[model samples]
Target: MTPMIDVVFLLIIFFLVSSHLSRRENRMPVSLADSATGISETSPADDVFTLTMDAQARLFLNGSQLSTDVFSSRLPRDSTQTVRIRVDRSLAYEHLNRVLATLTDRGFQNVSIVTSPIAVSRP
Candidate 1:
């Protein structure tokens, strides 16, 4: 009985630490662009892949900076995989377009640009 209880406690601690670490990937320092009509809801599906672009137009995959070639190589062969791109608001359109073009050229059909909801102005 004592050994069983210790194993359960260890498992619980492992899960808690892993969950916290997993969330750290999405907390990169990119300031997302704002959209008045953007849907702010996010899917909880594990199949979703995220790519982030910082203000300097540097691309990151899984919180690690990667070049376009490496990024393409790392993409799943399933063109239908859902991809979410989060770009800094200050980045130029050309930078965004380049990423879009790469995805489109590779036959990715389920891609989305992530943006924050615009703050409402209160009088």
Candidate 2:
């Protein structure tokens, strides 16, 4: 009887550890785009792939910096995959155009540019 209880305890510990590891492996963060208008009353969907660009032209995926080669390799090859690009307002047009071209070449036809909602200031 004691042996059976010990086995159950071990199984529980194993499952808990495995779950923790799985959750830690997926750390991608979704970035929201800026908009001149206010946020909608309804909440947006949580599932999305986000790409970020910084003022210095640094590129990131879910907050993790990635080179052009690395980014291209990691992109989903599926033609149906939806991609959202979040570029810093300070970034140059040339850089943004390059990224868009890369996505198009990689077969990601459905893509959206994200932006922040406009903030209303009280006079």
TM-score (all chains, Cα) for each model: 0.83, 0.61
Top candidate (TM-score): 1
Give the per-residue lDDT of model 2 (tens digit) for 58-77: 78775578998898888876
Regions more than 4 Å wrong, model 2: 1-34, 37-47, 119-123
Full-model lDDT, candidate 1: 0.86
- 24-71 per-residue lDDT for model 1 (tens digits): 668888888778786654666467888999999899887899998898
